[model samples]
Target chain A: MAGIQKNISPTHIDILKEVGNIGAGNAATALAQLINKKITMRVPEVNIMSFDEIIDVVGGPENMVAGIYLRFMGGIDGNILFIIPYRNTLNLLDIIFGEKKRDLFCEFDPIERSALAEIGNILAGSYLSAISSLTKMLLKPSVPALAIDMAGAILSVPLTYYGHVGDTALLIDTVFEEGENLIKGHFFLIPDVDGYDNLFLALGGV
Target chain B: MDVVKVGMADLKIVKNPQIITTLGLGSCVGVVLYDPEKKLAGLAHIMLPDSNNSKDNTNKAKFADTAIPYMIDLMLKKGAKKERLISKIAGGAQMFDFKGKSDIMKIGVRNIKAVKENLHKFNINIVAEDVGGNYGRTIEFNTNTGKLTIRSLGKGTKEI
Candidate 1:
């Protein structure tokens, strides 16, 4: 397998950033509608980095987090991850269920877990749909999987998929915020090594 | 004592009075080989089961098959005796539950199996193991004491 790192150029990065922007914009709008709160998203940052660096970007190896993972296929195959810190997860749960019953370290009930998964499903669907419409590529996302654990552990699952081909991953990252209540979350779009060519090609990159 | 951090798909060797660590191992396995008599240890955070599966095998520490033999050679060069080497392993967790039977979902199990097979190839005894759960782990291997400290969120900390 050829390394994606050798072929990535500044133009490729710009295209990915644009993808993140459109995708995250749609996701933010979907989230706002879900919670009925005004959500703002930062301009997405596209980075090609090692697996360790990607973990650090989310927080750290041991940092407690709630992660939603999904795999997308069709014109392009890749993984999309949504990460929120523990406190932010609590705040999000509070808003979604309209209650503050769960503590910081408490286990989530079956309904709470399903709620989290549905949120992931919506966010991933919106994000991928935006990209699909923009590039005219058919993209289908798998059923969302939710895991509340260490950032390193959760990210390692996706990193292993990329590990077979290369050490570095191209990450399109976007952060979402909901004002002073501090409902911040990070969204990462990681396309596989072989998928890069198809992605850049679909975007009309030479 | 200094703590040497091993990044993902990386490996490190430390002598007495030092600690070697790898963080947040989800479906990845952290393999620790220690020579208690020599007070030396090596830690490798391996991401995949085999190097032959990938065309890019340049990163030896990234796969279980390549990494174990590489660490063994390094430890031997540093005066660690092969006969005294024992293994302590942790990590290799599912992390998330996926309903489908995709190969990716079984990576943790595959990683653990590959690790055990590699260690066995080197004739190293696996003395202790805490693996195959749906949680992430941060592992620190202390060379001086030949102990592996595994810490997981909400799972409590334990040493073996």
Candidate 2:
């Protein structure tokens, strides 16, 4: 936490904010195509947070959730998390994929796996694109890892919430709209302060 | 003919004139009990490995741990002989990457284990099975023929 406050945060957060907005749109489009329906997706509200503050803000222990986890590595390294409720996953899927007939012995198998992958690809791709277009910073992404679990189990890694110099945590809140379902996910950017310092120190005569 | 559909944490038993099926089983396990002699077949679309985790302790057909025993008992009560019972199992997928490390979170693997253990406890042998991996499976059982088919989009259909 101390290392985070030692570094400046403004410039980094401004860039992520713009990228997350575009990412939401891309995710919406992918889901639309996957389900073969015309879906309207709304841009999400973006926020930034360190590891600790996020666990507290994303609702308490009572919440049961299922979501997609995608990690960004290469030029930029961070994780993307989605929190979808069980009832909502069905409602949203029903609109996009249509309802499963009770008498039909609904075969919803193959599609579920692909649906998760497609969302990850689109949202993560759009994010990298947005960051490059806005800040001219080149980024690379990896294949996403999707799973369903409690909010606490998903954010397994330890995060430094409060920085040494700054007491506040940065958070980004965003929403995605499609059919009647509204999907929300949080984007957190953690600068390995030492990594950034190494970049600049190596470049400059320090 | 009626097609009986089972939902999450639900179970149904039907014979003759009806066929039973369940879809999109990720970590969930689907257990089928058939009595060829009596022409009675019961299928359980179970969510977890064991019903012990559920709040309802009395209902044995709810979890992977209890559903098999429960189905066999129901069949026995309906004039189905104990020696005539046969078992089949499917579903339990790895869904996510675990950094190539072993973890207890793999529901697909755990489901398979629970079903195998419980079946042994009840002395029911699995006649067929399709389980373990990252892919989701849809299982269909034809009561008329006592045959079950497992389907995955990425892979061709196979009878297990």
Candidate 3:
């Protein structure tokens, strides 16, 4: 497990701080379309630490969540992590799209999937494009997977995120307001070496 | 071709141009079933893996175990054949940082499991599935062609 290095890796942290600042800014741009309103995203709180540290602060196991994980390849290759609590997702959507007569997450409706996907898509694209400008690689993004809940499930594998600073997980706090709803969306940057390396392979650069 | 929205735990059936849809999936599961011959497709979004654990029907769509059975029964009542029917599913993303410590909200994994169980109970197989990840998936089903398209953020649209 790589711990945070203050002396030897200040440069790495600096680069990531810039990365996150831009990523959050871009995410706000994407949200503007769906909600039809301007989004305000604050500068993300960043840290560099091991996986165990993540489990400590990220609520608890039973927390229902929504997330988008994308593998950036070549020009800008890494993990782009984004998440929000389930209840907040609906509340945020309701705010952006106006009051829904039905539950924002009415299970049988797939329309919300598109709405959420659009949000994730634009954020990832914006983040990658920013990174690509720096890395000079054509950043390609993968699909967004939104997990509805985690009741009655088993831990089968270790998951890594690449949405952080200086080899550490990057954490962000996003604020969304459309109408009467003000919702917060949290973003994480986990370092997924496997996914990153996969991108290298995809472009025949691996 | 009327539009019917299915609630979390509930089921809806329609004939001739009926559009049934759902909103955000996050880690929840979307189960879409359609019979080409009958031109009937029913979509259910279930939260948890099983309803046996929940005594309340309110969260029916939140759990796969309960929602799968509930959806299948609804289809049966609408005169869809068990063997003639096939299913398509999407949405299951790991949304939070667990640091691999606990599988608490592996809801995506459990949702898939419950869909499998309930489908098995009725002898129906999932023809296709788009699942797992840090990304959210959106699915659209056209009963006319019985085609389901899954759109993942940044991943583009894929027909399963």
Best by DockQ: 1
Task: Indicate whether candidate 1 or candidate 2 has the larger TM-score.
Answer: 1
Model 3 ranges off by over 4 Å: A2-8, A55-58, A95-97, A101-108, A150-181, A193-206, B1-160
- Give the fraction of reference interface contacts each candidate recovers: 0.79, 0.07, 0.01
DockQ class, candidate 1: medium
Tens digits of per-residue lDDT for model 3 on B14-87? Answer: 65576666444455677887776888888876555654554333544445666666666787788877778888
Model 1 Cα displacement at A53 (Å)?
0.7
Rank by TM-score, highest first: 1, 2, 3
Model 2 interface CAPRI class: incorrect
Give residue A2's error in model 2 in angstroms: 42
Q: Can you tell me which runs of candidate 1 are displaced by over 4 Å?
A: none
- Two-way TM-score contest, 2 vs 3, winner: 2
Between candidates 1 and 2, name the one with more favorable lDDT: 1
lDDT of 2 by residue, B61-153 (tens): 446777787788778888888887888888776656745343334655766888899888888889998877665566788877888887764
Candidates by lDDT, descending order: 1, 2, 3
iRMS, model 2 (angstroms): 14.5
Question: Every model's DockQ, to 2 decimals?
Answer: 0.76, 0.04, 0.02
What lDDT is reached at residue A60 by model 3?
Answer: 34
Candidate 1 lDDT over B63-100, as tens digits, reads 99999999999999999999999999998899889988
